[model samples]
Target: MTLSRLACLLLAAAPLALSAPARAQAQGQPQGQASPAPGRTLRVAPHADLRTLDPVFASIVITRMHGLMIYETLFAWDSKLRPHPQMVESFSTSEDGLTWSFRLREGLRFHDGQPVTARDVIASLKRWMGRDTVGGKLAEYTAALEASDDRGFSLKLKRPTGMVPFALGSAVGQIPAIMRESDAATDPMKPVTDTIGSGPFRFNRAEWRSGARVVYDRNADYRPRAEPADGLAGGRVVKLDRVEWVIMPDPATAAAALQTGEIDIWEQPGQDLIPVIGRSREVRVERYSSLPNQAMLRPNHLYPPFNDPRARLALAYATDQADFLAAGFGDERWWKRCGSYFVCGGPNGTEAGAAGYAKPDLDTARRLLAESGYKGETLVLTSSYDIAHIGRMAEVAGEALRKIGMNVDVQFADWGTVTTRQANRGPVDQGGWNLFVTTASGATMQSPITNIGTNMACARAWAGWPCDEEAERLRNAVAEARDEAGRMAATEALHRRLAEMQPYRVLGQYDQPYARRANISGVLEAPVMVFWNIEKR
Candidate 1:
């Protein structure tokens, strides 16, 4: 019902959307060539605008997409989810497993024509280890990360940590993107203005217009590995001469552009318009994300009502996943009812603590609210109207929270606004939020070590900042586990604690697909949609 109202609002808002010509100009396309020759230039309409240039600074999917285009990592995950060396030519670990030595591939050069060195890699690793979840765990055991030579580096740990290689190859959440030594030293909290890396594509800084358009040109100097491309690893052969990411906030406008061949690929087609696009012979719709994304309702643990674990558990128990999924995806086929906080079929995925996760009992919720003495506290629930999926989830969840007797204040803002606002840790009255809905790529939730949200490290924890010593202990145990059985046991314990704490309500896992013209090819069906190896012909 809320989405129906939002639809009418969207139609009224269409006129305000950016036009093709204006978008083309913003992307630095010539006046006459509103639609560039398809094969040479691949025009894309991403789901959101490229807000941040620095990949390590923000873990948002949009920013990560940009980072993947312009930067290269030392290691990457293959299609089979195995870690492989990307920038590194070879590596070895001591028998004790405390020291890891890595040698860089020869002739790795940044966009500015400077050669990539071990110092750059060391600096980047240090910065990323301070921010990323897996890297943070590695940092706990790391005694030193230093350059062994101009082309090699070494990481000495206090004890054996089997996760070092995996951490270096991590693909989600503040990815360990290698940058220039100077840019690597830039504060992780601040955005790096420069976009220089030894990736397949080079950022056209002169053409970037934040919320309007961003452009990248193929890097002819980039040296790909001899191995064939597999997922995020191996050779990233750039077939297109240029890639243009045009920002169109309205799905209707983006669909129209795609239908007219104005854009080659629609990174995320709105669910409401899928049927319309499917009817077109020129356009084809398909799922792109390798793993389903799980939308979550994160409750701020710093504020009233939600400050209590009982209140958190009560909200999680009361909420229904179907309501939110239906509102966001529109079709039942696009979503799965997974009560799991981890990826449903992933390594650590299980239904152990999920029995009551999706079983909504409003009576129980109200009683728990009474027990917790939630005295009419205003829960400021914010939603991102800019992204259709997130907006619908937030609206649906806001209604559900109201049904469970929450004093809900539903605020709709752009994704950028929501991202900025959700970071405020102050009181709700002082511009902080009590509840917000966001989704994680299945890659991020593969295991407890990779799932930043599940880590209950309080002051250093993600968004909601749920601090539970027992949860942290369980997570550490899983990280340090020597075998699969031990890992599963620790994960089960962690999941049980997560259920009780309910820091973030795992709404459900849903498939968000992309659309492309029949001629477009080489689109990788990976967790983070990549533009490399894509051919327009």
Candidate 2:
């Protein structure tokens, strides 16, 4: 069905309303205290539901957004992609740069009222380092992470490198969110159910409904940074007394809510509905980040067909970036055809080895498939039904693969289920997936070390587990390069190798704008949507 027709159908349906009991539970009114002012609450229609609260466990954007509402990081990235101190009061590196010392800002406290300390920071970093791509790179250089006092901690590196702050401050991929030591002590593979954090808001777990809404109240005792908000850095002053995530999976329902002022912000509006939403003077659609979102086609590397490089190359040859972009995003103004493994127009964007597969070639794809000795194995393609663009991308991919004489099975599920099922490494009959479509912000694709898609660390690589010794060596070279020229050269080489290996297919890139009520102000332009520093005036 067309998105416009879907929007029309959904808009005709009556809007969903939040239950009164849920609101009362969210507010948690005390006996003697007066109710909060009407305008003090900010209701947001997020792109997806908040299923995974632990950011360390899953890399989903909704989970990361939830973590940002309550969790605080040691450092944060600014608009220029530079790292700055967020939780740290003071920090310095030794002359040789092998030792780094940091002291926590005074008055930092978790939602439970416990003081933030070096122990919490150490534990959080250790946990984050195990899962995140950039954090894993940082772990390779670390010798010891020790706490000197209640508020001070030091990281002793085995070798001097300049990526310490970047890893901790990364706004892309898995965020390095600091949690209480006890919560951080949970296994990295396991989800931490505790919601306690030291950020400007507190997660109201009592009011959370799985598919309906998630609530957060402002942390009254929270402290803000002195600097003004820039990107995800600086002060996180919460002007709103309460922030509620009213989950609206339907774009038309969310767009209508924004028009009626029932929802303060709609995080991601469908490209086709932008014109409809813009017709209302009460709502304004604005692109929040300068970086576009890059779409990827990832294949399971542990399975039979994709495990062979020739089969992977056949998939890439069959893919046409223009078709995927047009199918996923209807409007050309909102999307672009980019073949760069690293995002096009980014710092390290390049087309070193993209010439061969710049356009679709059915003959080459069939020839490669025949060479790979594939005996018509059914490729299971998993996609999310809730996310429109992702589901469209999967459909386009399935069509392309079938044209190349490959058996395809497209499976549709909710975003949470898709994310969970993609982690399995077994065969398709055993709950494993052969292919899926996903996306990453342009900021995350800017560097070889930061981009999880390019990781080839064998068992430790991203979900696909694409492993190559030469790709790993090139990635290390880019990370260890001291000068810009050296870094660029190493990056180009790595990009070339990646194009040959076909770890994942780059479909295209596009910018998605956020629609908000006109009265909403102080929305910071970061790679990810952040709720702090926003005023619902």
lDDT by residue (tens digit), candidate 1, 427-468: 877889999988888888878888877877886677788889
Superposition error at 183 for model 1 (Å): 1.5
**Model 2, range 1-537, lDDT digits (tens) per residue?**
565785575467424433345434433534355546759988898888888889877777889889888998899999878899999899999999899999999999988889999999999999998988888888888999999999999999998888888888987778899999999988998889989999989998877778878889988999899899999999898888988888778777777767778789999888888888788888889987888889999998887788988899998899988888888888899899888878888888887988899888999999998898888988899998688889998999999999999999999999999998977878898899999998888888877878888888877778888999999889888878899999999989988999999999888899989999999998998878898888877
lDDT of 1: 0.83
TM-scores, each model vs. reference = 0.94, 0.95
Error of 1 at 339 (Å): 1.2
Count clashes in each candidate, considering only residues at least 3 apart in sequence or on different chains: 0, 0
CA lDDT of each prediction against the hidden true structure: 0.83, 0.86
Q: After superposition, how far is residue 13 of candidate 1 from its true place, in Å?
A: 12
